[model samples]
Target: MGSINKTDLCWGDNYNLTEWYCNASNSIASKTYNCPYGCPYFAYACKKQNDVCVDSDGGKNWNVKGSITFANSTRTDHCSEISTGPVLVEYYCDDYGRIMEAYNTNCACNEGKCTDYFPICVDSDGGIDYFTGGQVTTSTSTIKDFCGNQLYNYTYESYCDDFGNANYKTYSCPNGPCSLVNGSGQCPSTTSTTGNVIYDLFKKVKIAGKVIQGIIS
Candidate 1:
């Protein structure tokens, strides 16, 4: 028999990278998984230590809230609980991997509804604007003066474009609609207090729109 030549061949795992990939993939496929809150799109690297599951991926380690999932089965129990208060923090990442927001559950008021109450930055002609959700309902008793007299209150909604901006002036009154004097400032009409009010509001809204453009720029 002719002498066999072994000198040209690689001796280790590098001999065939394809086989190594297939073996590694199969090993990953056979294991159970408890995934993150987002979804399966996030790859999780899992291993059991001290009889509990831990993930090696960048996602912070969290307790498996429910059950486990396998690769081949049609059903999955991939849900996991991330205790953002102490164990981990939740954040929002943009499509380009930019970190847009970072917040911890510990800062929440109600403990459960944290995301619902985060502050939003807004732009307005008046100045930088900031606000929270829901109009706070006040009773006649709550709307009293320092000297025990009554106060005014009003409620309305406004709209703006993609950038945060205020479209109208906030109005409040001591009593009710009787307190409001409504009119617009379209020129050629004689100027009155009502006309001035509308004109001022329009000017302010225009300024706010400009501010929005500035911010996005």
Candidate 2:
């Protein structure tokens, strides 16, 4: 907003506002003037002196790289974030409690935030497909699994696929309807029915397998 000593209004970043002022002839008049600071912006620029600078997420959406955190301070200017390629926004408070913004090109705009180091490929779950709590991940090469709240009797998985793309999957316990798969409540064991008997093959330790050579040197 660029409304000075008037009741009219205008919108945009650093836009000129026309104001009705008294000239030397002492008559009501109109003259358009520009603000040296910034226009009241729903734009990135701060509009007025009392304008505040804040990050609702505390910069949580920005990627964390090279020990960098997206943050603002009450003290000196901070090279806070990036809007495009390598350009970064430096936010500062003028002596009058006015928030001003500047730009810095001398930055490593990794993942759209200023960082001391570049990003690295990462899997927060240590390459495991399924995880509890949150599946922490980072990188330009790695991605996170998409799923809703974990379902009961359901096993989730994440891993690379045959064609080399990442994959996330959910599976029901047991091949058929989920049954008590031992006590761990997971799937892996199979059950079969013989003539007049029904027995849990996995519990019997009667699985078919052959031991190979010892651990390699």
Candidate 3:
């Protein structure tokens, strides 16, 4: 007969709940589980357990308690955040499967716990310049127009994030009359390029060559 394999602690990747078990690469990790309740006070997601005695924190909070009475109870097997730390009131099977024990377990890390997965709000405009996100307040980005308040029209440019999302930035105009053109802001320019304008103005005008040379010199 071959040697028998010993009982092993459960493990899985907590970042991705789709993974339910631990592999050679990912050993001794959390397993995905959904419980009927919530524990919403961890720096990481809340680790929840179903009515059964299964610790869904990918087994990170699981321990071996070889001597505990097996409690045949429902929803008793659960975990919750204790205060505002990395501790949990974890309830999980103690070796003997259905036999569970509660403890103030300390976890090195927290993942795939409290709070369901949902897409956050994103705004195309940077600010209230344009009514983009509407009444919704969760816009991670603001939908700002090229011009700000119509009363004081001015355009702005921002840096793009790694995901190609526009970052927030603001810029003011020359503090004079400005207008919006084709969604972009346009303002009167009082100054002209030095050399280019000088050539354009003097080249066409019929001025004495000597006078032009002297003026330029």
Candidate 4:
């Protein structure tokens, strides 16, 4: 069991719709459902017959209450079955079924397949970029000609959990501008100073441009 919030309170069973409800983990330490109102997150039914019940909103095996009669025929089940909102969250899972990254709808803006899987961004010049956790992990650059040789290469970087396991990153090279790629990879071989992430990406791009420009000149 997990934890319960104000949404989990209910006076009826699964069949009889009641107030919003959620469940916790088996240990019952904290409420796993942290979604706010109007946010598109997961939900479960609270089906305890007793007067007051705390439901498990995060764990599996949630029960949905059907038609119910309260005391006598004079009373009616006015509670309505709760419906989930639009898909606003995206999750990337590994082969072992573990979540790697999650993107919010407003941020990722990917519909349908992208709403559930990872996001892939390609620039006008065919440069690609991949990201998770609001950070770039992989990038591929546009193709370009240098010294009569078609230069092409890609850069790759990834994030690591506390246990030092690579999770997400990108890759790109020689072609032109870099683009993003999805999936886990080695930690970025390069490190930078503390700065806004976007700024850091711009700085790296500028440095790469300088190097390429010097070679081409």
Candidate 5:
């Protein structure tokens, strides 16, 4: 008689056929119910149990824990989402995919442009001027005293900054009327007595006429 193999099992064995058959069939069956190639039930009950677990706890996948209020909307448990405010909020994802926050105050206040402040010169007589280079001068004429008899010329050196603020230094004429020539005070070479007399007479006539008009009024 032929000898029976020790490993051979009879058809009436008590062990579950599906479990034993599937496990013994392929290495893939140990980790999953799905059998590998060559198994009769290869893809049987293989609907991916891990996928169901992942879908059930979908909110856990979001790294941020709180509800985020965006400028226009609200979101909960979403990664890589952006939000804005009146001031800029610079956000970036870290190497570990975590959202980080930073404030960007360097916003475009004046349309992303910059300008410089300028200096200006203002005279004591309330005249405004600017400083260019050598000896800038501003002048104004007023009646000597309130009598309106003689007109006096006032001269000032104009100095200014980028901001239009004015500063002035009084200029006194030594020999004649104050004049600015090439950014410097120039005195007349010869003083005319005749010219002065004529000017005085004309001023007296003008003042007398004004006084008469006021009296009539």
Candidate 6:
């Protein structure tokens, strides 16, 4: 007859047993038997609360947006929540956890974020001008009116509106009933027969004759 010794080990819902027999000189032989399912001695302990569990490896809680459930324990898992409002400017975090800022142009005009209007006018007579609150003279030009004696210079002014449309004020010869000046700054006689007129005509005829002679030579 021999004395038999047995020991049982339990770990993580798994069990194992070992048996030993003593020999004559009090020496023992032992054999270990494993359960059908292997016993895991180093199983991690996770405490679940509020339907959420802590990651055994990273030791971080996993949360998801809305009622969605997160299965994997990867660090790349994240949640996205969207909020809507009439915001002129906004700031948020990206997927890479970067803080970014953005502007809403739809609300920009409503928020009075606009630049001042600078009014400009292009005249119909191929001239350009700028206008402020009142009228301004933009250009001047000389002209002759009826009776061939209204020699005068005219000034042009522009009237502008907020919409940038411009209207020009027209001007006419201010000096009338004036005589025409010759090349020598002398007023020629309007009468048909005068000594100065006859002398001028004769001088023009002599100049023409000299030009014809030079051309022939």
Specify the highest-lDDT model's number: 2
Task: Give all candidates' CA lDDT scores.
Answer: 0.24, 0.39, 0.34, 0.26, 0.28, 0.29
lDDT of 1 by residue, 46-137 (tens): 21222222222222212212222222211112222365433223322333221222334332323212323333323221231112111211
**Which 10 successive residues of model 5 have the least lDDT summed?**
141-150
Candidates in descending lDDT order = 2, 3, 6, 5, 4, 1
Our tally of clashes for model 3 stands at 15
Residue 107 accuracy (lDDT) in model 4: 23
TM-score per prediction, in order, is 0.19, 0.25, 0.21, 0.16, 0.18, 0.16
Better of 3 and 5 by lDDT: 3
For candidate 4, the TM-score is 0.16
For candidate 2, write residues 91-110 as lDDT tens digits.
44334333345555545655
Error of 5 at 128 (Å): 12
Task: In candidate 6, list every pair of residues with a backbone clash.
Answer: none
Clashing pairs in 2: 1-40, 40-47, 129-158
Model 3 vs. true fold: TM = 0.21
List candidate 5 segments past 4 Å from native.
1-111, 115-154, 161-163, 179-217
The positional error of residue 101 in candidate 4, measured at the CA in angstroms, is: 14
Candidate 6 residue-wise lDDT, 1-217, digit = tens: 9765544333333334344557678887665555443322211112122223223223221221111122222222222223643333333333322222344332212221212222244333233111111232323432221122224222232344344454443222233222323211112223332221111111232333442221110
Q: Show where candidate 3 strays beyond 4 Å.
A: 1-11, 14-144, 150-153, 158-163, 189-217
Give the TM-score ranking, best first.
Answer: 2, 3, 1, 5, 6, 4
Predicted candidate 5 versus true structure: per-residue lDDT over 115-174, tens digit per residue: 221122333323322111233222332111111111333234344434444333332233
* Candidate 3 lDDT by residue in tens digits, 1-217: 5543333232232222222345689553445443223211111232344323344432423432122222233233234555654433344443323433344433322331222222233433433332222221232644333444545433333334445445433333454433554554434444631111112111342244533421221
Most TM-score-accurate candidate? 2
Once model 6 is optimally superposed onto the true structure by TM-score, how far is the C-alpha of residue 188 displaced, in angstroms? 24
